[model samples]
Target: MKIIVFLGPSLPRSEAASIIDAEFRSPVAQGDVYEATLIRPDAIAIIDGYFGFQPAVWHKEILWAMTQGIHVFGAASMGAWRAVELGPFGMVGHGWIYEAYRDGRLEGEDEVAITHGPAAVGYKPISEALVNMRRTFASAADAGVMTVDTARQLVQIAKRQFFPKRDYEAVITAAQLPAAQAADLSHWIRRHAIDQKRRDASSLLHWFSQNINYLSAPKRVAYQFSATVFWAQAVELKRREMLSRYPGRKLDHARIEQFTRQTMGNADVQCRQQRLEQCKP
Candidate 1:
């Protein structure tokens, strides 16, 4: 089965390949799933995805993929969040973060978000994820590195900061506790931090490997696929599958845009000169 995985930051592509043996893609954004459907892949697993800095993967694309017989799986980062919303439609969710989100224990996107470098730099994480910090805090408390109350306070403090700026150091500084106490807590976290996102990412890879055969099986669902007008436009844009004016010829998006511009320019276009004169900047 051809399995395409949208990935980044949570795990390196090389390591994911060694484990899941699927085509590794950059963190997903708008139109990625629609593009993946053009490949006719049997499955798609999402581990990381973009939002805020870029468009996020669309839910309609996921639903469309499922209706087309592609098994969809999501875990970690934005992937897990999508799964929670789409699970009733046959999208499978994996990992602890998914569990937390599904059960309402975690409700914020920043709980799994981290600022990171670009692909050329291997998407190196700049800010820490709230999920990782919370996990680390709980681990530290269990290991007697800090009190449970202290860990709880830290978790709350981290959540209060903007997601892009929520690192452990910032959380400690924002707490405004004594310097000695902050220093010791920082040192303890340095020694015992938990990488919940990475761990969940690994779980997805392993699950993909073990369940490859079944993943591509046709989904038996109660609801039929709905093709809305917006979804049609989205697919046409992303896949460039527009039927050409020439019979049996399909034009890609670039060619279609070229045709439109040429047709419009040649056909006598209205400059809207009167409207422009009246409009205020």
Candidate 2:
């Protein structure tokens, strides 16, 4: 059987198909529920990490796919929600479900309805499992069983596991990077974490404090090494060409590569992975 992947309007078919091997076929164009259902996709993957938000509006797409006897898998923001709606789908990186499962964190049924509305998708137990995974990854990170580099890789894997895109970017002015970088990282981390509501000023302060301690000589040195290797992998993968459009003028490939490489070595990368591993359901 072939898996026909349906991505949102902003993405191209070839780009979406790149993630799957023989299991995936040429992607069908489906910008929204109407066009999406018309393709009769065998499966649907909701990837909105690049948009930096969950496409909550697309929930019907999953139900429709199911109605058409199609399977669905989700990763990252959109994927987490999709997995809850469309059972038995894969999740890649850090997702809300992963976070709930990881940190022993659970919201009452009422809380879920705020976002998903009550539909009984077996999310309660999944939240518990996600919290357990969070603890496991936390223990692993603390014990040095999983280094920051390894954790980052896991985050990348998690992102790829559910989200369809290979990279995420924002259209900030060049002048914004100096200030935006820190905020961006913090926001991204919080988004990937299960305990988003708990991420207050104190949380930010504590995280920076620990991060300061972790960025010592050898640790920094090891991460730089890992960063280079990761950059090489992205290069080999030819990820730079995937972007169809960029705002604030044409995108800078070299700079993006550098930024991506630097992110691989950053402390937040570890947190993202650990959180996702903990949270993933």
Write down the lDDT of every candidate, Cα atoms only: 0.79, 0.34
Q: Residue 261 lDDT in model 2? A: 41
Best by TM-score: 1
Stretches off by above 4 angstroms in model 1 are: 240-281
Tens-digit lDDT track of model 2 for 189-266: 344434321221123223323444322322111111233332333332333323433334554556544434443555
lDDT by residue (tens digit), candidate 1, 108-165: 7889988999999989899999999989989988987778998899899988888889
Total clashing pairs in model 1: 0
The candidate scoring highest on lDDT is 1
Per-residue error (Å), model 1, residue 149: 1.4
What's the CA RMSD for each of the models? 7.6, 24.0
